[model samples]
Target: MSMPEPKTAWRLLKSAGVKYVRFVIVDIFGRPRVDILPIDEAKDAFIDGVLFDGSSIPAYGGVNRSDFVAMPDLDSVYIETWNGGKTALIFTSVMDGSRPSLRDPRNVLKSALETVKARGYKPLLGVELEFFLVKGDPPMYADGGVYFDGHLLHTWPVLEEIMEHFHLSGIGSTKTHHEVAPGQYEVNIPAGDPLEVADKVLAFKILAKSVAQRHGYTATFMPKPFWGINGSGAHVHLSLWRDGENLFASVKEPREELKYAVAGILQNAIANSVFVAPTVNSYKRLVPHHEAPTRIVWGLGNRSAMVRVPYYGGRINRLEYRHPDPSMNPYVAFASIVFSAYMGVEKRLEPPPPVDTVAYELEGVRETPRHLGDAVKYAQESALLPEEFVKPYLALKEEEWLSYLKSEGDWEKTWNKITRWEYNAYLVNV
Candidate 1:
């Protein structure tokens, strides 16, 4: 069903009775916050927005900050899956009352989307979300099947329940299944314009978790809750479409199609990595042994490559960047991918030929993997991010990085491996 536009959000408030119409938006770390207003106050929030102090949230505005507005974006508005009688869920963009904050993650994504559109192609993003389902508040799924296991059929009942709700909500889900990690699962959603897809992502997560909760279970999209076992990743596959044509389609250059897209993604991938994998825990999922992308390389059907064209090919055909976990803010992450792809297209960057051979066994590229610092440097120095960002990106995560550094064993995170240290401590810690 078509959603009511922002201009009409106020109409919904005026035309219908709403028991609750609160605005929900995520902070820098992808944590959701709500500005709950009585149904009566929501009318003003649609246009004038609900006024709130910006100093309350962590890793956000300064304590002595000025005013910020939660201008509702009805375009992003979604109804929570289990609405009782009077309340509904919607998302908003935090504006400076004059203009949206460029520092705001949502605005950062919008800026990138605008840039890509101006470049002549509309970017389409498809995300393959892999997460786990547990039985309790922390939640666990019914099976222990690992890595493309077929036990998904066992959970079909639960999957069917969730998918039915999504279909009714006009958010189409492409597929769902068991992942490699025990009890881990994945859901693939249909592709759409970046903003629209991001909206679905917000809805998907809420519904996914809520449905699981209702069934006496719990769900987590966190990147690395298990630490050593396989961590979840929201690996996104992207391609450009203009006037109903796939810009990344290999049809025209077939051989070159694969290489060109790969080169472009790698060139801009590092800078965009900031958006794709934003949190400190995100780095923990980047190790080579964990099926994570550690190097700047691409290959066909190789789980280890940073970029891979999954076996399913066509105009809907595209490259999948497997590095991003669920920790990223959907808006920023999607835009970042589009920006990188635009840079790739404009520069006509040619990827090193597809690693027809195994990428792990391939020679010449650096053997050790790249770290988050390596990626931060790339994005920080990139003309794209530097030009559009509101401030030095370094100032963005300094505190979080330093905080993680203070932990006893986490300090050597960048250049060291966790398991390596554990092996060295074996039986000698007495």
Candidate 2:
């Protein structure tokens, strides 16, 4: 996709009758921060770029070197009608001096995409964003609906409003349905350019929260907000294209490239866990028997495996990575998946035989990291990501893990159940 010129962006906003423009940036932890400007001031910001303190954001910079600029990707401009169509939002790229910051989550994914493009392939991503809506201080489910329930539940109207917002914002939301757990819902974003898809995923979360709040509820992407029920997952559907052909498609069985990509993902599953199942509470959702992936294995149409090749046949065939939860930073998660898959293709790595039956019942298959500390350790030992990114990410995650430990001493005893401390720490913030 080509980026729009500054003049084009200014004209588009003016034509839309936008009174305020929001310069949006995603921090390392996947939280979005915004700076809103009146239309007149924003016109100048489009050319000069918006300056902010990078040190305030996690993993960006130190106090001494805190200067940074947010250069809006004009093509990402989207007008929101919730505020009477007066507010326009644009996703920005963080700039360190004159160059893009490697620490910027979006730029990391951009670098990974360029690497894939140089090897004659274009990657496409479709994301399924799952989250829950609740109310009250400790949080309670807003509805009693189950999977595919279409009843006129309290949460249904919120989902409808969110979808309407997505449509107005140019996000292609293909499907929305009630998930297995109460108050849980999922929205499927159609396959598109990886970067655009990531932006939509982030936008979906923000919109869901906004719409839910207007209805007197809170929307959370927390992986495991409650125990003994299914947790929210951000299942990613990935496909690779070269010369306008789907590289993973085949008539009889799985293709070699598909197997190699799965192998690369499985090989780095341990290290990649930090990016996918990112939060301290994310590990709680990776356990078996809750429709979540626990084993690092792949199979055809197997939901239990971390990587499952959906039987779509022909050009539509793709892999579904089920390990990731909505708590992840989509930009970094997609980048890690692309880099791992590319590594497999470059090395010709072969995946293990497909698990035909229940993978959780099978022994000997490698299990994903059981805790955030284990994920941090595995990431520290691997060279999967660049040193600059990996160093700060590990430090940030390590601190998070230590804080969790401090809050709930002896995690081994309380790992099975969601504690009050865990709920207080992550329920609202995540």
Candidate 3:
């Protein structure tokens, strides 16, 4: 479905009985922040914005330059699904007076989408989001169900509610299923324009957790919620379009455009690792034998390859980026991939031979960063992340890594099934 025309947004809200409008925006760390305004004052969003003190937000800005504007994107307006549709939800891009903030994650995605548009193409994105539905407010119990089991019978009520909510929120999901790990589930949100897909990803997480709460369960999207289990990943499926043709689809072999895009993604995988795997716990999920891709390689229908081209043809053909997890900011992560592909198209970069063997078992295959510190060091040396973002992002990630190092003992984290510290830090908070 297309975004509603800006002039009709207010009318639609009123027709839907929206008593309030929630202006939403994500921070550098991908945390959702909001400011609620009465429906009567909603028109002010289109004029300027609802002002807020940005300095108080984590790692956003300081008091000296904290004054900021959150200009709502009317095209993104939707009725709140988890809240009985009583609230109108609209996403915002941070504004420093009249200009978009360079640090805003959503604006970064918009900039990348513009580059694709300039090339006479549009990016289409679909995301597979995975999370755990553990018991307890602090999440001490893992639902006693295995992969693809009849856990559907146990959790179908909540899953059904989630599906209904996704549809009502205008972010329709393609599928929902019991995942590999116990208490883990995967919800596949339908494909859309790059910017909208990112927005929907943020929205889905918020609404999913809220719904889980109402169902007496806490949904956690932490990359590795428990030790020695399958971790959650936000595996992205992407393809480019021009007018009506799928650029990734080829009659034989693969198209030049597809080749160049794959080349760009693989070439920058290590440098862009920090954005793909943003947290300390993210690395815990990236280790070998965990069903997560750790090497920089691509192959047709290969789950072990970092980039997998499914064995399908025609318009449905696309690349599945398997490296990213749910912990990173979807906006930054998706835009970074687009920018890398942009470089590939412009430079006509070539991809290496597709690895037919398991990439992790291959003797000399290149690996993604093994730790947060390693990812930061590699990002520091690369230009994939815009110059404005590197300094602040590096500071934040490095601080997280240091805190992890000082807090956890290697033996306990590996053998004791300890989650008290991790749960307190990330559960329900991130």
> What is the C-alpha local distance difference test score of candidate 2?
0.86
Off by over 4 Å in 2: 312-316
> What tens digits encode model 1's per-residue C-alpha lDDT throughout 275-307?
787655567677667787777787777788888
Best by TM-score: 2
TM-score of each: 0.84, 0.97, 0.93
- List, residue by residue over 84-135, the lDDT tens digit for candidate 2: 7898878999999989998888898999999999999988889888898999
Sorted on TM-score, highest at the top, how do the candidates line up?
2, 3, 1
Compared with the true structure, what per-residue lDDT tens digits does model 3 show for residues 67-102?
989887877766776898898778988987778886
Pairs with steric clashes in candidate 1: 133-140, 133-141, 134-139, 134-140, 135-139, 135-140, 139-218, 147-180, 271-379, 314-317
Clashing pairs in 3: none
Clashing residue pairs found in predicted model 2: none
Better of 2 and 3 by lDDT: 2
The lDDT of each candidate is 0.66, 0.86, 0.81
